[model samples]
Target: MRKSPLWIASFLLLLLVQTSGLWAQSAKKASYRNNNEVRTVQGCEYEVLKGLAEITEVEKTRSKSESALGYDEYSVKFKFTPMEKGQQLMADFGENSFDFFLRSGYDRLPVGPKYLKHYYVHKGQKFAMEFLQTDDKTCREQYTYKSMGIPNDLFEAQDSIKAYKIQIAAEKLYKKEKEVNEAKGIAMAEDAATQASGNRPPETAPEEQPKEEEGPKEEEPLDEEDPKEEEPEVDLNLPSEEELRKKVEAELREKEGLKKSPDEMDLDALRAQIEKEERAKAKAEAAKQAELDQKNAIKREKQAAKERKKLEEQRRKEIKAKEEELRDELAEKLAAEKAALEARKAAIREQVTNEIRRESCVYDEKISGTIKVISVEEGPTEVESLFGYKEYVVTLKFKPDNYADLPRKERKLWDKTFTFKLDPKGKSANPGATYVRIHKLFKGNKYNGFAQRLSSGVCNDIMVYSPDLPIDASQVRK
Candidate 1:
């Protein structure tokens, strides 16, 4: 009977489950100590360190290229027997941690399509194992063992239970497959016997007829009893052994003649030709891929350069804008300083004009000498403008040069010249008074004198001045 689709699917699923379980069991028991094996093999002694295992008795052999990943992997068969029976060393290291795959036998289950060719294990008669180094502490890897030489530390302490477990598992699988094959063979034999018996003729006579008997019994066909027809003629033109030998010998002669030619090949020559072709194919593929990669790299570089240039331009524009702004700000500041300077100059001019205008002249026509007034007291002239002017005393100032001409004795006298000022509406000054009384306050003191006698003929002479000096009203500037 044909198998149902459902049954086939169930069988496949069952097989997957069993196979996964087996691999899982093996993986769980695959751990080994890197520093545990310190035994000597051949004539060489090896030391093992933590995460670095060393095995002796390593035999050199040709590397095989038929690994799952299509790469050549090196193998060193053991010279000394393994420490644990039925347990073999399979090196597996990666990242920082070094590991050894503890296998029951040399032949190991391939991991998967991805990792199968990349990492593999092989069985050997008697071999030592060691880990030279690892790619990292956390990745799977392997290193050159014989090339790196051996490490120090003969052995390390570790549990051996795991190694035993793997050995037991491998044995179980091997026995199970053997049993299955034997059982299949027995079942096939029984099937063949049953088929043979069913084809045999009856040995006894027929039973008594029933009430509703069948019509006449059918007789066997005569053709079945006839002897088999003679077999048809067969083609037998195949060459005899001697003819084949002669043909082979001729072919060998032709090959020998070709070898004698300059262009012909020997064993090594034929091997070199195969390797050269392989290398050429590999190089061509690599060159094509490299060209494609170069194009991609150039594209990326151009993009990066464009971006950099764009950034540089933006920075330059920003810097230029800032420079212009600074220039504008500096111009505004200078303009403000210039305006302030002009205002200060104008203020100085106004101050000088006020000082010049405040000076009053005190002239003595008797001696035709004139002196600038230092102080004034007015009771004569009176005038008012812009609000009512009040009577007041006014003080004037003189430079050092003006007093230097006076004699020492004359300098002691308070005043020798006088000028008066008045406002009409001011009660302090009487505009109607004919004789105006004036007072001189000099050197912070009061004095009165006539102006004519005080104006001595010589500018530095000491002289007496009559009291109650009078001055012309027109002499004062309006």
Candidate 2:
């Protein structure tokens, strides 16, 4: 069979591709030398495995920063041998991706992305995450490129057989750091071996020099100062393999010069200006506080004076009210005393008037008489007959007040001897001096039993009535 030259060339190209793919896969497997070993990086303890980043899958994905790292990503895993709380973590993802982040627990306590310090990890936490992040130069540009407008490419697409350019840069940085640490370790080991030979050469620190072949040296006797020599303790600040990788990445990022950084002299000037402004502010605050205090003191003094005036007015009003009350009480008491004295005077005047009225009607006794019979005669009993007449003897006697209750015989013996009987219709004497009826001449005829004899003034006839005897003898005679 005859083969064309073009067909032969195509077969050769395909064979070369398959061979390279196998070589890369085997290389990746062999690269993780310290995969299970515990090491401390950036104040945190963890295990790291170094290998070329494998592009396992490719698919369309969305992002707000630098567009899916050009649709290529690496899945890196990590394990903490014994995790603890509040540990600061940092890792070097290589020079291609200058920035790295922790996934799964610590996202909330401030610095989220990369390039600065301060990530306080969660309790007992580890991460195995895929990174499809922007390169440092592209992330700096979105002061313009909108995510919705058009996606900015962080990198070009990568080949299946090898890593992306950013990742290759990172790998070279990590390998260089590893070389440096290995050199330091070797130099220290050699220095210690030299000391064990017991012949002290110098006291300077060991140098990190190139390795050389040496023949066995015989043991020498100990010098005077050889026993005092001591190897230095291990350094806590030395970067582990993982931290060395990140430290290299940080150096490369700084060199890219994304933004201008201030040097030591500029920082010093900024510090001094801040201090000057603070001092001026403190002086102004003190003056403002003093002015406010003075205003408050004046207000308090005015208030106290107003209160004193109010109290003085109240005291004066109370004194005036008490004096008026006392004057009213005095007026009421004087009016009552005047009324009592007037009532006593009226009673005395009534008693005197009654005594004068009683004295006006009294009289003295004046005349006395005794009753006597002279003869018995008959008088007419028919109409139109001769006028009837009867006659009796008369007598007068001294039967005074003391002698009024005597016997008739004694009275007769005292009387003048004469018949003194009068007509039955004639008036008789009461043997008192108060009033009497007597004979009088009338119109050519003589009659007796006339109206009372005479007047006794304002009371007419007197009635001298006594308490013990109703009638008394009068000394006056008719």
Candidate 1 lDDT over 1-478, as tens digits, reads 7645544555565557555543443322122344444422221223322222332223222232333323222333223223443333334321232222222222222122222223332333222444233322222222323312222211220233344344445455556656766888999999998998876776998787778867998988666644667767988999999999988877897988642544654869778999999999999999999999999999999999999999999999999999999999988998988886777567556544533442322234432222343543443223331112323344422222334687877555535433233311111121222332233333344333323332322121222122332333332222
* Candidate 2 lDDT by residue in tens digits, 1-478: 6645544554555456445543433322211122343333222233332222222222223332433233323322223211332221233333232212212111111111221112222322233332222212212110111121112222233221133333433444456556766898999999999889897668898888998989899899766666678978987887799989978777876889533345524666767788778878877887887788788878887887788788878877887887788778877776766665565456445434533443344334443432222322232232211122222122322233435577888555444432221211112112211122232111122111111111322232322222222222231122
Best by TM-score, which number?
1
- Cα lDDT for residue 346, candidate 1: 75
For residue 203, what is the lDDT in candidate 1? 90
The segments of candidate 2 whose C-alpha lies over 4 angstroms from its true place after superposition are 1-280, 330-478
For candidate 1, what's the RMSD? 29.4
For model 2, the local distance difference test gives 0.37
Q: Which of the numbered candidates is closest to the native, going by highest lDDT?
A: 1
lDDT of every model, 2 decimals: 0.42, 0.37
